[model samples]
Target: MTTFSNYIPQSNPPLPPWETLPTMYDLPSDNPEEPGLPDDFHFLQPLLLYLTFQPINWNPELVYSAADLNLYYDIQHPLWYKRPDWFGVVGVGKLYKGQDLRLSYVTWQEPANPFVVIELLSPGTEDEDLGTRTESAADKPPRKWEVYERILRIPYYIVFSRYTNELLAFQLVGGHYEPMNLTHGCLLMPEINLSLGLWQGSFRDIERLWLRWFTLEGELIPAPTEEAAAATQRAIIAEQEAIEAKQEAIEAKQEAIEAKQEAIEAKRKTEQLAERLRQLGVNPDDLDEFL
Candidate 1:
């Protein structure tokens, strides 16, 4: 029974809250609105990727990787981004512009897109990470698959589930992603002279199946701690070998001294025997003729 004209009129159509709300910059990086915050596995798995993402064919200074960092892809929508679990770039500097740490990875500003992106599948993000999620509406931003595959065109996309210890990998080919085959239990990337595979062992003192890097020949790439431990072991072995060598030298010197002492004693006995033969009035030089 109230007159409709009395109420304040709204716009022709109200925009969605996302369209009018604060941009990514206005909100804190860890804002509640952000999805996929790192759980225990998410944190550790990405760390493993970051530690062992060495590309033997590339310069160490030019190889860079990051975890859970905002990767701004679209220049049109500068605020739109995806925070990958872990990503690596081959031609980028370790620091932003070789001067400072990067707050986020902006593709438009950077020289290269990610060569590889790894997503740890979780209950919350399994569908999206595997590219099976429902497509987004036309007005909404594209899904992670679309962003990585179609927009950014990342070379490699990897998904791993810790619960089942399963690994899935895709390589971009002819502008679309194709499932990659595992060679020798690893996905080989010859350009980097490296491989990606799951390793069953202890990491960070926790033993489990973990996704890690390897050589194309299926050799495990040692983490920094593992490398340090190996170096220590080599040093210990070298020290032991040196100690053994020193003991051998000492034994040889002692044997030579004993031989010299024995020779001296024999000479002294011979001299005394000669003196006795002379005192007995028997010429010692005549003994050879009697023989």
Candidate 2:
């Protein structure tokens, strides 16, 4: 008999040639390169990224993957690359297949584009983030504002300034970003089913309002560790209550047994007194007349 493997036809798409792919650390020329930001800026970037990864209800379906703060997006254009301080892409698989890992996010290869982009403003890129001036308007691939708001068409754009403790949120409307007003330092993103706000709490020993996500009712979203801790506390309380109830039942049973034994002893003593009167031979019938 002919082997089944030989009968089946093999079909596979040809992989791209190695020469077309750029080498590691290959950054585009037009990319706004901020080699070094302030220490506080660096510290806040990872914290915000971690907070985004923590909350359970934020992305129940796990559509987005919270990528590293420094990973670059390799746009097909030779001289165009955009890297956000922190970014999240919806409708992308959490892991690339089983073996292939992403060194950098290439838009053509990835499943979906970034839905929201966050820029932690520094001294160098503050003006560009706010859409103030464009040095290479005609020559270069537009300004950062035009690229983020117009080209990429990202739904939500957030800029946070550590120097001034300022937070600004913009929502895409009519193919452009419009500044969104905040009520009590909170802006709701209905598309993502969450709110972006400044949370005042101690993270890594710093007490400040760090850029974080929250629920619709203005509750701070819980990290993975915090959720687990809450579940453990509830389990401990339930176990203690069960033990206390069991102990009470045991004590009640013991009290009931003791009461039954005392009644038996009292009945036995009364019977003995009656027998003693009979044994005294004083005529049980005559004892009633003497009384």
Candidate 3:
């Protein structure tokens, strides 16, 4: 029989890297047991949300934000958890138990559920993040959508796609999550007196479109570092203005002294002229009008 290899010919051209190589997400670690590695976008997008979230009506001490932290929801299961990309809580202390940093968020223990939850979409977890992924098994833990929508009943939900630069928002209305349209490139949440939106700017020296919080009127709520920088600038301007005022005062004083000297000299010359006129046998009193 003819060999199978003899009938197969070499390919005409080499396959491109896209076709030949595995993507980063697909390339598993040598340790299959190890957790998946997080890419740079995953690191940055959540940090932006953490930094810019400032609730206008809430107490700063009671406002807490978490990223990639396990949130235990069900008291019955006690082990069932959903780790959001980023979540913000109002009326919860930044510290766990009001004294220590949180290792993980326990929803039953906290006073309230998160006011807002944001997820940055990646190819690996896109379907589940958007709540479209089906149950892997009937008895497996509930999907993220069910946990947030039904169990926790989180007030606001947000998902952002880095590849397409798309942002979507949902609000809890009538016991269900409802899609909310962007008003002037922003989604306003009246409860917090703050808005969420995308802004094109540099953060951490990397320039890109970043999601940030804004005032309901669409004013950016500045980060703490930005607030400090602006305060420093104001101080510098105030110092410069004070220096200019001082210089102007000094110049005005100098001009007034010079004017006084000129008036004194003029009076002195008039008296001397009167003495000379008297010496020339002219009556100074009679020459007063001409002088």
Candidate 4:
């Protein structure tokens, strides 16, 4: 009698799951299950994060950040995902595999997970964003906090409320997230050489207290627009300085010419006086000795 058994096939040299598993294109990037459009703050805050998410220790080409992008964490459940307001990853290509733009951030296919994630608080998602909400069913998806802390194990998690202008931060330690104390109004992450804090400034022409990235020393990271503006201002100042330097040089030259003219005029007057003295039988060279 022949026994029937299941046979598993394997690849020689063992191809990684990324090559065999569903890629970003196979995953659904849209949030059709959820309803409602993001408010203006949602759009603006994330934009600011995306613009200034330059990790000082990481290469610019290797740093990638997204806002409102689906982050697929579970390989078993490829469909499950969380859309972070803003998330940043280091040691990963800015583009997908250095070739194409990513439709979604698939953790299994990517080299590294998000190092930091920011959630902008709203009335609807405040509980979930702050880890106050718990999943009612086992089959249901985990909360945002669970995914960030337990599953993906993101190093830094930040939440900000525009309404209250409050900033909260958490650091993953010993497989769990602990509340991080703000050091001088900012959460310092020395690994990435950056800080997360609230800035009372204008972004996108809207003036308010906004969540922003900062240097480890608590200096604000300039956005692209701000950097451009700073460059222009520097150029203008340089031009003004050059103009002032040229004017000073011209004034010095004029003074030198005037001094030379005065010396020549005095020499001519002395020569005339000497000639007149000679004509009167007096020596002009002896005048200084007499004086």
- Per-model lDDT: 0.91, 0.69, 0.85, 0.88
**TM-score for model 2?**
0.66
Q: For candidate 2, lDDT tens digit of each residue in 1-291? A: 779867977788676876567753353333356543435546665555555543334454445544343333335554466656777776666566535555566666666677777778765677887888755645556666777776677788888887788988899999988999986668887666677788777665668767877866677777665568779998999999999999999999999999899999998997787788888875556667888
Local distance difference test, candidate 4: 0.88
Q: Against the true structure, whose TM-score is highest?
A: 4
Best by lDDT: 1
TM-score: which is higher, 1 or 2?
A: 1
lDDT of 2 at 95: 62
- Score every model by TM-score: 0.81, 0.66, 0.80, 0.84
Clashes of each: 0, 0, 0, 0
lDDT of 3 by residue, 101-201 (tens): 99999988889898888888755567777777746466677877778888899999999987899998888888888899999889998888999999998
- Measured with C-alpha atoms, the lDDT of residue 51 in candidate 2 is 59
Better of 2 and 4 by lDDT: 4
> Compared with the true structure, what per-residue lDDT tens digits does model 1 show for residues 2-33?
58778777668888999999985455436445
In candidate 1, stretches whose alpha carbon ends up further than 4 angstroms from where it belongs are 1-35, 273-291
Error of 4 at 5 (Å): 99
Displacement of residue 39 (Cα, Å) in model 1 is 1.3
Looking at candidate 2, the ten consecutive residues that score lowest on lDDT are 65-74
